[model samples]
Target chain A: MKEIVVISGKGGTGKTSLVASFAALAEKKVLADCDVDAADLHLVLNPKINYREDFSGGKKAKIITEECIECGECEEVCRFDSMYYPDPENEIPCVNPIFCEGCGVCVRVCPVEAISFDDAVNGEWYVSSTSHGPMVHARLGMAEGNSGKLVTIVRNKAREIAEKENLDYIIVDGSPGIGCPVIASIAGADLVIVVTEPTLSGQHDLLRAAELTAHFRIPTVICINKWDLNPDIAEQIETAAKERGIKDVGRIRYDTAITKAQIMKTSVVEYTGGAVSEDIKQVWRNTIYALG
Target chain B: MKIAIASGKGGTGKTTIATNLTATLASMGKTVQLLDCDVEEPNCHIFLNPHIESSTAVTTPLPDVDEEKCTGCGICAEVCEYGAIAVVKEKVLIFPELCHGCGACEMFCPEDAITEIGREVGIVEEGRADGFRFIHGRLKIGELMSPSVIHAVKIAGRESEVVIIDSPPGTSCPVIEAVKDTDFVVLVTEPTPFGLNDLQLAVGMVRALGMPFAVAINRSDVGDNDVKEYCQREKIDVILEIPDDRKIAEAYSRGEMIISAMPAYQKLLETCWGRIIDIHRNWGELTS
Candidate 1:
């Protein structure tokens, strides 16, 4: 089966909106929302969760205050600088969960063995039922690290469901940026579609995103969402993509109906077969053909 | 005070709000620093067009195993959390990209065969944008060490009276790294369903960090009123609301600051700043 991952380097460029439309248009497909930190495709797909499990992306260090040496050894060994003395009176360094990278060096250096490397419930993954088919999604907890690992878990589950059902595709909605989570979503995908806009920030970010895909030797294309907002910049972006040997698969016009459809809790294609829907359908057709 | 303008959703005008606010405050003769911490994309430079004075390489430590000193006992592999090291057939192989520079392998090696080496993942550039100090980071393509670069950018910037940080989108480590330690955070979001959803997550994130935060709604007229209603119901302060104007979009599309493109936006931004100061002072009183 082929996998198509939709990404946008700059956020709010309509990646989820397009993915929701793809979910409505595509056949024999299992969806994956790999934007675990701030997932929005589920809001559009309205998935009913079938199964879920706590996801432990990595380990975190916890210090036992009672059996403390407070030699400051753990603080010195922690490369992440996660250890801090919240109360100077107590003198024991507390591990700041947000700053912890789960490297476990602090645990190893604690002379008194007061540090315990414990599993952290960083997030949760779900196997859900949607109107299109089965879906895999996740929710990375607030202030949690290891989002890339959670993304990989979601994709693997989607792949498993697709293989078991003999599905044709796994369409994934990826997060913005060329960071760890975005890399995890598109690293092994069959095709990568970068949904961008006509703004200067969008254009700048698209180049980096494209460079990342090219570095990974992944087949990639571009979709300029809200292309009409700046037709001149949109044209310039398309020209730049061509110079980079990246295909411009589609240009979605700025439409109020798309947001209205989002509020209505359905895909644009399912909401209306109007002008914006037509534009998305064209993008869908080109994406499928490009995948082949 | 250090204030971070961030959004859970990308292109929700984090850069726009940050650039405009910094520029406006600077032009009004306030000492401000703009720290663009979105290393992966780093688009604040596009709008600000800062004159970069110098760029410092942002490097992370990677374990370099000395084959000669090694017995190939596989102890380093056991201690590494990232699985970056492997003893294949008693031959050590090191993957520098996977190493998080935590020094676990080198620290735990019985023979002390492993040594730490520098790996350049990005660069932090310090400059001057208009009347304010500017610093931004550019992450190497395909590199996953954005947090390190963001940290370097935050460090590289010269501290000023009002520090405005433009953070990356999302609620993960990179975002956390960019937003941490700031006095206050301005959660920038649009007024759509996706915006509201991501805003809720962002709220959870800032609340978890115990940060004093306020919301700024961009393109407030476009999608729905759920965002404003939610903020009001939650008793969260709505600091600023920018209407969906064609000129604002046009100005942003051309990489022009909103205050420069439309002078009236200057007042809006100034009012936003006033609100931030007031709210932050109140927060300080309560916390202290």
Candidate 2:
């Protein structure tokens, strides 16, 4: 099975939109939205969740105030400044959950053993059936850390489903920025399609993203969205990609129907039979050929 | 006052508003500092075209095990929360990428065999854009630690009278690191469904941090008005609205700041700054 991951180093580069359109075009494919921190593919695909699982990405230390001795050792050792004194005159401290990085040093150093480490529910993952195929996605809790772990879980679940159903491809919608979650999404993929625009920021981020894929030794293909917005920058991007030995797979013109289709809760290919739709179709064809 | 410009979704014009606002503030003779905390892709430098004054490498501490003094009693491994260390058959293994530099393992090591060594993850560049201060970070490709780099950038801009942080697109840890201690957060979003979806997530993040925030709708005329209605219902002040114009896009594609390229957006951004100050002042009154 060939796995194709769609990524854009910068956010809001239409990664999910392109993935939704690819889901409509590809056959016998399982979809995974690995952008768990802010998953948006479901906004268009409208997946009906059939399986749900609670994810405990990491542990958070909780201090039992009742068992506390008034010594301030825990606060002294904490690098995160998570220990909070409820009363200014008192020594008893409470752990602020947001600031705590779950390092567990407080639990180890507490004289009275007042701190207890417990599992925190960081997020949830779901396996659902969509109009395209089996879709696996997740939602990271607000302000929660360890999103890279959640992305890994979603991708593994999608790979399992693909194997069970004998699917031909697994198309993943990756998160923005080449951070931990992006690394987790791109590693071990058969091919990575980077969707970028024609702005200077777009060009800069695309280069950084290409560097990441090259470090992982993953073959990458480039697609320029809204190429008509700045054809000069688009040409520069193409030349840069070629210099890096990356191929340009497609270029979609600036189209208003892309957003309109998203508002109507459908892919661009399904909502319109216009020039943008034709561009997406050609991109899909190029992707399949490249994968082969 | 430190203001953070963020959007839960990418490419929604966070940089556009941030760079333009910084330029406007500098033009008004304010000591403005713009820190692009999107280390993964720091784009403010491209728009500002700042002259680099200095560059410093940001490093994180990774544990190095001393084989000579060590008994592999597994005490260090037990104390590590991230499982960054392990004792396998009288040998210690360290995973530098997984280490969070919490100093737990090094401090609690029974044999006193663990020491911290610096691992460079990114670099922070400080410079001047006209009269305003400009700073940004570029994370070494494939580095997982961005919050550390962002923290360093924030520390560099702490002394400025007005600091504007341009945050990465996401409501996760990196976004949190960028906007946590700011006076006010300005969320930039378009009016589409996807934009609204991510904007709501960003709003939840800011509210969870107990930070006062407002919204700025870019490409205001392209998508529907659902975003505006949602903000109204939530009682969030719509601070700025920049309509969809081909001229703006052309200027942006050419790497020009909207304030200088069009010269009309200066008044709009100044008005937005006025709303931010008003909201921040009221929020301070309620809290203090």
Candidate 3:
């Protein structure tokens, strides 16, 4: 089985819109949304969840007030500052769930053993069915850490489903930036499709993403979304791709229909069979060939 | 008052709001310090064009195991949750890239063989831009953890009365670190489907931190009304709405702040800042 991840270093560059079109065009494929922190692929795909599973990437610290000696050692030792003075009225060191990194440093340093590691329900992953195929996705709780680990879980689930059904491919929509989650999504993937816009920031972020891919020695194909927005910058992007030895798969034109499809909760190909769809179809074909 | 601008997703206009807000405050002759905490991709520098004075490298401690005094007991491996240390056949390898610098391995070492060493992960640069003191964190390539550098940037700019922080995208460790002790947080987002989804995440993040915050929706005319509806349902204050305008996009492309290119936006940002202060005051009253 082959895995192809669609990632854009910067956000709002049309990664999901392009992935939705690919899902509509691809055959016998499983889909995964690896942007667990703020997943938006479901906005377009609208997957109906089939199975839900609890995800605990790490532990969270909770202080037992009754057992407290009010030692304040945990507060002094915490580098992340997750422990704080509990509302001066109470006047005890407390653990802030949002700030905690689950490092267990505070828990270990707590002289009274008041602080302990507790399993935190950081997020949840779901295996769902969309019109296109089966999709795997996850939603990380607000302020939850370890999104990279959650992305790995969702990707592994997608791969497991693909293997069970013998799907030909797995299309993954990755989060923005060359951060932990994006790295986790593209790691061990067969190929990476970097979707970028034609702008200065676009070019800069695309280069950063390409650098990350090259570090992992992953084969990459570049797709310039809204190529006409800044044709000059688009040329620079193409040149940079050549300089980096990354293949420029194809260009996607500016289209209002893509947004229209998103509003209707459908893929662009399903929304309109116009010139933009044709361009995306060509890009999809080229991407498959490049991966091969 | 230290205020931070953050969002759970990228491309949600955190820098746009932060830069413009700083410009607005400076126009009012208010002393403002703007710190860009999005070390991995600090774009506020592009908009602000701060004249960088000096930059200092930010370093974190990683365990340096002494092979000469090693027992190869693998105790370090068992103690490290980040999987940065491993013991293999009388040899110990340390992957400094994965270490979070909690000093757990050294604490658990029975032989007293582990020593903590520092490695530079990024740089914190300070400068003046648009009449506001600016500081930004720039992470080195291939550095996985960015909160350490962000912490350094925050420490470098703690004296300003009104410090505006531009936090990185996502509702993870880095964003939390940026918004931890802020007096108020402004969650910048657009009005699209992606915007609302991420706005919800950002709101939850801020609420979890127990920080007083409101939403500033940029590109409000581009997408659907779901963001507005969600804010209304959740009783989240929509402090400002920036319409989708070609002028703003053109100005952004030229690296000009919104209020700078469109002088009319100056008063709008001032009004938003005032409302933010008001909300924070009211929040303090309620909580205290």
Candidate 4:
């Protein structure tokens, strides 16, 4: 099966809107929102969840209050500053779960055996059925760490569902920036669709994202969103893409209907019958064709 | 006072607010230091037009295995949680991009063959634009972690009297690292559903960190009243409201700070800054 991820170097380049429209156009595909930190695609697709599972991305170190001798050794060894003196009166040096990276260095350094690693439920993954096909998605907890692992879990679940349902493609809505979660999403994807804007920041981030895709030897196509704002920059981006040998898939102009559709909680294709929807449909077809 | 402008959602006007606020403060002749904490995509320099004085590489350590020490045990790879070290074909491969530089692999290598090595993950630039000192970071291509660079940027400008930070979009580690120890946080957001959802996440994060924060609604007329309703219900202060003006969009398109384009907004921005200072004062009293 072919796995395609729709990502942008930066966020708010109309990735979710385009991905939702692609979900409508794809023949047989399972969707995954690998943007676990701030996932919003489910708002549009409105998937009917079939199964939910707990995601334990890592362990959280907790202080055993009874055996604790607050020698402050854990705080000294913790590079993440997860271990802190919470109570000055009680002299209790405790672990903050949100900041803890579960390095296990504190556990070994604590002489009183006060620290113990416990399974941290960092997030939740869902197996849902959308209007298009089965979907695997997850939501990372607020102020929680280990988003990359949660993304991997969702991708694996999507692959398993695709195999069971005999699907041909896996459409992933990837996270913003070149971070751990983004890396997890793009590691095994067959193709990457980068949705970018014509602004300088957009172009800069696109270059970084393209460089990363090239490093992994993954083929990529660039789609310029909001191309009307700066046509000159758009032309420059196309030229740069040609020089870099990255395919210029297409461009989507700034359409008010896109935001209106998002407000209505529906894909652009479903919300309106207009030029933007047609443009997204064409992009999806070209992407599938390129994958083949 | 150190104030960070951040939102969990993108296109929520974090940069717009940050740039304009710094410009207004400078116009009033207040010394301001603006740090762009979005290392992956630092755009404050674009709007601020900072003349960079110096740039330096920020390096992090990765494990280098000695082949001659020659016990090809997979133990080093097994201990690494970041997947930076991998055993491939009887040899160890180090993917420096994935490495967090925890030094655990080197410490745990039983063969005493592993040593730490430095690799550049990003660059930090320091400069001045208009009247405000600026610091920003740009992550190296294919490098994943940004909180490290964000931390470096924040530390670079912490000594300033009034430091303004433009944080990356999201309520993740990068955002957290940018806002930690700030005297006040200005949460810039829109009035859309996605805005409300992510704003709540941001609120939860700041609260968990024991920080004082307020909200500024950008594009107030574009979506709905959910954000204002949320702020009211949560007793969160709504310090400022910027309308969805095409002039603002046009100025942003040309990489112009709004305060520079429309000088009238300077007074309004000063008011916003005053509100921030007042709220910060009240918060300090309440917390202490």
Per-residue alpha-carbon lDDT of candidate 4 for residues A76-110, written as tens digits (9 for 90 to 100): 76778777776778878778887787777777668
Could you tell me how far off, in angstroms, the CA of residue B54 lies in candidate 1 after the best superposition?
Answer: 0.8
Instruction: Report lDDT (CA) for all predictions.
Output: 0.91, 0.92, 0.86, 0.84
lDDT of 1 by residue, A91-201 (tens): 798999888889888877787899888899988999999878999999999989888899999999999999999999999999999988998999889999999999888
The superposed Cα distance between candidate 3 and the true structure at residue B253, in angstroms, equals 2.3
RMSD (CA, angstroms), candidate 2: 1.2
lDDT of 2 by residue, A1-292 (tens): 9999999997788898899999999999999999988889999999999999999888898888889998888999998888888888778899888778899899988988899999999789999999898999999988888899999999999999999999999999999899899999999999999999998888999999999999999999999999999999999999999999999899999999999999999999999999999999999999999997
Against the true structure, candidate 1 reaches a TM-score of 0.98
**lDDT, residue A187, candidate 1:** 83
Error of 2 at A277 (Å): 0.7
Best by lDDT: 2
DockQ of every model listed? 0.88, 0.86, 0.61, 0.56
Identify the candidate with maximal DockQ: 1
Q: Each model's TM-score, in the order given?
A: 0.98, 0.98, 0.95, 0.94
**What does the lDDT come to for candidate 2?**
0.92
| Cα misplacement distance, residue B56 of candidate 3 (Å) | 1.6
Query: What are the per-residue Cα lDDT tens digits for candidate 3 across B1-288?
Result: 999998876877888889888888987888999999988777888787789999999999988887777799998888787888888896889898789898888988889889988899999999999788999988776777888988999999958669999998888888888888789998988877777778888887887777898999887887788889998888788999889887887677656788768899988888898899888889867556
lDDT of 1 by residue, B1-288 (tens): 899988888878899899999999998999999999999998989998899999888999988888899998999999889988999988888887688888888889999888888899999899888898999999999898789899999888675788999999998889899999999999999998889999999999999999999999999998888999999888789999999999989999999988888999999889999999899889867556
Backbone-clash count (model 4)? 0
C-alpha lDDT (0 to 100) for residue B70 of candidate 4? 41
